[model samples]
Target: MSDSVEQQLSLFRYLIQTRSFGDSTLRFLDSLLVSKDVKSLVEIRSSLNQLLKSESLSIIQSITAESVHNKLIVLDFFVCAFAIVGDLESCLALRYEALVVRELKSATIQLLHVSPLEWLNFVEDAVKNGFHAVAVKACENALRCIGNSDVQKLGRDVISDNLKANTISEITRLRNFSLASITSRSVQVQATEYLERKTREQQKLDLPYKEKRCLASTSFRNGIKRQNMRKLYKRQTLLRANSEMQGQHPNLS
Candidate 1:
């Protein structure tokens, strides 16, 4: 391959490793398709498929987490791949996937330059497909991007009219329930910690009393043993004195 092709391939390799796609990456891929034969495109697709099939892609997806920007970059790579094969349906599907992921709706509209009505219809389709939460999120995102008050009102109406009532209610209830549970757990933890501290304090306070009682009992037992020894010694002495008196008085008897 030529030096330029080598550089492009290097850039492609770097982008794939980072799980990122940008305009430069797209241009590089497109250049490969246009300058080289169809085999180059096939090789590119094979490489992408290999990457996508690996555990790394799943890890990248998971790491995207709540980051809309990272999510958008991943979506862009998928879109670039689908666009390379001229698979419009697949490209649109990636956008739908982006809808459910956080902040990606706004990313999609910004990057794809999707018109207000097109995105509105996309959101509608998502609702019709039973992705109520996705639809609601997309509508909410569109409101921020769409500067026109008319379009904003239209989006608000779509969310109010077309989205499922139970889905929204359930989401709200779950969010509130989660907050309440967290608060309850925090309070319980504090109460348990306080009780444990009081118990430790009580044990500390009672320690000296317990020691004093033990020492007093030990002294009383020692005193009783000493008194018993004295009584035993006096009885032995009296017995000896009686024996001596009997010996001296034998003559008188």
Candidate 2:
């Protein structure tokens, strides 16, 4: 391998091996990020993924806002690899993970730095995942947050016309849809509804597989046949429904 490639690999190795997010560690990471060479990009992403996967979800959730922001940067970089490879699902999941982390209030005002191309991919993926309403809102927020100046800096050619014009056009198109009302809600309300609906939809889709798996376990089989189990399931379902409703009506307990 060439000296530059070898050096990048070494830096990638160090990033994966180091647990600290101190100044020196970040500087090394920034060097690899600045390189932006596609030759070792996949390897870099893999290293990031390995490091992320090593941390438990609870630990990640408990980290400081700064730590979470740093992790978000890593996720954004890793997402770029998938985005470049045209891996739509992977891109969407990474974006979703970032969104969930943001919703959890792990950090405030920390941007994930998604490119226009990735934004388009995320919108497409959200539509395919039956969250088209969420997709439109995300686009609106992106344009709004990036504002008039930086959007131009991101690249004027991506939209053919101009970023401002194209962004307004896109938002208008998204707003014309029926689901735009959902986006009009407060951010917290919007996130809660979107998550609840998505979760229920997913559960519905997984019902058959879940049933099949349940049948294989003696405990599950016995529980399903018990009268008390039926009552418990019904009560749990009611509680979940009530919680979703309560989220919409903030005045309720």
Against the true structure, whose TM-score is highest?
1
lDDT tens readout by residue for model 2, 1-253? 3577567656655564454434565455545544466756766556544444443233345444566667676566545544544455556666766765554442244343444444555565676565666676666655554353243333344333465566556544654452554545557697899999999999998998888777778676686689787898999999999999999998987
| Model 1 agreement with the true structure over 59-133: per-residue lDDT tens digits | 446765556667666876776666674555455567756554533353445334444555566655554554455
Clashes of each: 0, 0
By summed lDDT, the worst window of 10 consecutive residues in model 1 runs over 147-156
Colliding pairs, model 1: none
Q: How many backbone clashes does candidate 2 have?
A: 0
Compared with the true structure, model 1 gives a TM-score of: 0.43
**C-alpha-based local distance difference test score of model 1:** 0.59
Candidate 1's clash total is: 0
**lDDT (CA) for every model shown?**
0.59, 0.58
Candidates' TM-scores? Answer: 0.43, 0.33
